[model samples]
Target: MSCCAAGAEAALQMDGIQPVSADELRLASRDLGDGTRQTDLSVPGVHCGACIAAVEKTLSALPGVESARVNLSMKRVAVKWRALDETPPDLIGALDAIGYEAHLFSSATDEKDPELSRLIKALAVAGFSAMNIMLLSVSVWSGADAATRHAFHLISAALALPAVAYSGRIFYLSAWSVLRRGRTNMDVPISIGVSLAVGLSLYETYYNAPHAYFDAATSLLFFLLIGRTLDHVMRERARSAVAGLARLSPAGTTIIAEGGERRYVPIAEIQPGAMMLIAAGDRIPVDGVVVQGASELDCSLVTGESAPLRIGVGAKVQAGLMNLTGPLTIEATTRSENSFLAEMVRMMEAAEGGRARYRRLADRAAALYSPVVHTLALLTLIGWMVLTGDWHNSITIAIAVLIITCPCALGLAVPIVQVVAARRLFERGIMVKDGSALERLAEVDTVLFDKTGTLTLGTPRLINTGEIKPEALAIAAGMAAGSRHPMASAIASSTRRSTLEQRSFDAISEHPGLGIEARSGNDLYRLGRASWALDNGGDEADTDAVSISILAKNGRILARFAFEDSIRPGSLAAVNGLRQLGMSLGIISGDRAPSVEAVASALVVDDFRAGLLPADKVAHIAKAGASGGKVLMVGDGLNDAPALASAYVSMAPATAADIGRNAADFVFLKDNLSAVKEAVDIAHRAKVLIRQNFALAIGYNAIAVPVAVFGYVTPLVAAVAMSLSSVIVVANAMRLRSPQAAPAPADTSAVSGVSLRTAAAKP
Candidate 1:
């Protein structure tokens, strides 16, 4: 909601514009599934809530458009529409008709911000003029004679005219653009006031009057430009997180052709199934699985962890991970546009949208603000004229009213805080899917966590490997290597058999929840549940039991293996922190009751449910929310996706299943559970600051507007007051950037539970 020159440069450059063809528009759009597509356009003229309302209203009314959302921080609009009879909607033409020049948005980080440079240059001119004019005005104010006062006024006029002409175009062009479209904006009143002040000063000087307001006119532009410049700079600072992330993507990658020749391929041209040759020091360009060689990757950008991860053939890797150790060849799984990096950028941009209730209120107020200010200014002029018959004083008072009641502060109240909070969350390795999620998170009083991936790391370790024979462990590892189940991963990592010693399995298959089954030299092998592998005609024993996995050959048990899911780092501190904040904690998990109970007791959470399906988890969340408390769900499995969506506000680990991660409102990239408490702390503080901003804006208006209308405030003073309020609001939102301590742990001595260390112990 900055009153800055957001789109003025685009308006100035809109000469001989042409409509974008439907084919071109279609080429730039993304297929969102279900016959719908999304097209993002960079609209440089959009800076405030009213501009957002105007553009979205115009675009949403088009033939096939389903929705249009404006991200003011990015100065972009995303339009979702269905093709009507194989034709794309005329989005570009519609925007042009409404006075906003637009083109397809490019996520490249190198684009320059023309409006910011223009503001800075214009500010320089206005500042120089204001200083010189103030020096001349001092002689006139110090009781100079008629001839001397007139001479100083003429010199002031010479300095002020060119400065207003140069520095004032930012508002003039913006006002003209909207006015010609039969609409009014915040800039309309500003343009009128500045114009009238300069005009009246020229008229008085011609009549040899004792005073002229050339100083007021030039100084007004200077102060207004200061606010505009600061607003633009602060907003760009807030959007730095997304820009920094975009810079990590390489421009292109080395592609290995079919004939074994390597060639450079641009990232956008790298298609699925293309073989990419990644060097030892290069960043991964797309999501892929390793096909040859091995490497250690610095996955800090993706996972928020500083440690290096080792990957070999068959290991899945995402884009933005730094390959630190050795060269590797990988087959791309998705195009650059659909890669994990692109998705993360989109999510971050979405977090800046004006979807929150507070922003909606601010927009509605701004939409109605311009007309009300016009009426108030006109009434003040008429009142003064009827009272004193002096047209000069009356017009000057009207100009003051216009400059004082600009509503810049009111427009900025909500969005500034949202941008600052989003930036803070991003710095902490948390991605907020929507800005409104922060508002909902602030109201949460109860927190429910999933057992496996949410509270624990979801990676289990084979702790009882000493009890199994080497031959039996090797056979189990061979079968386990083919499955992605947690226990299978544990078995594969714990027993490292050489390629020659590894048993060759003729066939291998996995039974969803049961386990892995394989065949080697006509001998059958099963590495899963005892009941399922032994083919016993009885109920499943693994549902309520501990983590004892059985290895059987030809229906006889060879060795019994056990695993333990390590507690996520900071789980104790996280649980204690949430409790310190007066939150009620519980566990809802799909794990065996014994495992879930062990983790729950260690974390000191009393309310627990285990062995529940996905639907049961959703029902539990729904039931908890029905009791007049907002429930925050934290989980990381495919089974938790439904529950994540059903909760009031949900969070997930970066290692979560794709479905669960997408469903959650917040995604924490770090392995530590401490991010949960950190996000909550930020949300609560943001809510408080937003309230404070609203109060400051309203309080300023309540005191300043009446003084201007009564002629006690001049146009110069009014301009200073308006701009200062905006700066105050921005400065208040910036308080969130200060470092906040992680919530301290609550006392756990009175709670009865298993020891966390023993439960996650490694042999």
Candidate 2:
């Protein structure tokens, strides 16, 4: 029977599938902050580039949908849509109409993969049957008598029938699913080839012919299943980072009630301001502040730091951190859905845009592959029939042509390499927000860095505190207490042990890119840049030593306060590594010229710009790109967000402001500057592998197809060839995980005049 006829007899019952209510969908969706809502759905049937294009195109045409994207590696679809009269889009129904079954996305990891289990079972049956049939065929090949050979052929037929029925269903069902919806995928040709081979073997067996192909039919199923199983396993390994993060969150936490009673509640029920008691060995359940106790925390998983962090009252802790030393009571600051762990998982699973260059070409090729293979097989059959005048021989060769030309290798080329590269970066504490960013990073020719908070630690310290009078220090510290700037923080912290009386200001305000101004009972006090604090022009030329902020009272300088920020660990190494790779490096900052120049000279970078506002940074990045240079911007501050978004590619540290982190293409958790060079190196290697994979895939078809068309290969040989091609591509991608693939740069442990601490204390 035809596959469609068989499917009709076992069609899915609509009532068995529960529909998600609109209210439930609304609650699950996230607001995109642009009058649109984004909903994610899991479609297990999506496995290739064609499926990605089809699903995205179908959903994007819906009434309220502004955009739709499919993540092939995750088998999920994200749709952004505007609400119409407060109604949610019917995403599940639209997918069902196109012969796909979808449901609301859940972060819960499945204990077992049903598809992988089924593939393994199918492989076992096919392998057992193939060995047994090959044994029977050997006896026939040795010239057994007519009656014995006939009986053996009948027995082989019996064994092959059950094996094909059980093992071949994997391909048959997938082929039928897409065929019924007026589409074709790689599986269509596979199903046709296997069925024809089996049918011809059965016919020759019943007629007592001299030759039969029962061994060929069973061996084909065995090899195809092997390839499918390995592909599934490798893909799973590439995406394990996201799954590992999901497993870190606890199901419930002990919430302390207002009346001093404690009860275990689900993570979702813990709200903002709720007091939760965390045990000494439990993972933190939410992003919150430690309100009552002191303890050491194991923050390796969250921040990629191996050392335990010491926390006390008012210290902020993020979710996924492990409490190691003492029990603590903390007030929750954000819901579990908005926690840091959840955000990382979301970023890792984000889909690449449909317009990415290589992805687009691959989709087009997959879409056109099925029809081209079908046409070639049809023409081969007609030409062979005319040349040989034997229908059996012609049909067999055509089946060989179909099986040999399968595009499995082409389909796995780009995505598998991308997944492997993403996993590699994830292991080093770097998160890639988009897969295509790696492709772009490989093309960068210039690297631009922000000065404060980026090249330097941005946490300045008071170096001239002992040189100034005690009363002057007291006044500066009191005025600095209200500001959060790194300079102000330094002053306040340095005077923690002073015995002077507290000084209060009637009014104080901080100006961006400048300093702080205060009014103290008709005595004007300024604590900031010299030019802005004093009216004598401040002799700007004399303020070239370090970062200097003047304390002026009534237009007279009371004290000169000098500060210095620690150079970030590995800055010298990162600069040298990038320079060795032949990239042009520069510094762009809002700091004074002296500070920027000092850092630039230390790193040996010649192109430097300072005293620029946020807009100026953006304009510089734009002009660089416009001049034909692909720029990689590295920054960490609220003011750096726009520049990060404007650059060709950007990276930010984990301590960067929320907006800046969100705008960056990559975020590194550790404080080391080496991550920038590491990312660039890995990207270059990944690009090389992707190109090699494409070549191997195209080159395989170029050689194998003609041999099958001319009757030089059999169905069994075609299966083995196709399977090996895919395995070769996968094995090449696996090389990325090897130690020799991406080697570490030379060690700089003894580099002079730089702090080697990888983690800094929170300010």
lDDT score at residue 530, model 1, on the 0-100 scale: 75
Error in Å for residue 254 of model 2: 3.5
**In model 2, what is the error at residue 687, expressed in angstroms?**
1.0
Model 2 lDDT, residue 354, Cα: 24
**Runs with alpha carbons beyond 4 Å of true place in candidate 2:** 1-15, 256-263, 351-355, 465-482, 495-542, 550-560, 738-763
The runs of at least 3 residues in candidate 1 whose Cα sits more than 4 Å from the true structure, single-residue gaps closed, are 4-6, 497-500, 535-545, 738-763
Q: How many clashes show up per model?
A: 2, 0
Q: Using Cα atoms with residue i matched to residue i, what is each candidate's TM-score against the true structure?
A: 0.95, 0.90
The per-model lDDT (C-alpha) reads 0.85, 0.81
lDDT string, candidate 2, 549-577, tens digits: 88899778998777767677778788888
Task: Single out the weakest 10-residue window by summed lDDT for candidate 2.
Answer: 1-10
Question: Pairing residues by index, what is the TM-score of model 2?
Answer: 0.90
Predicted model with the maximum TM-score: 1
lDDT assessment of candidate 1: 0.85
Residue-wise lDDT of candidate 1 within 235-338, one digit each (tens)?
89877888988888899999999999999989988989999999999999999999999999999987887889988998999998899999999999988877
Candidate 2 global CA lDDT score: 0.81
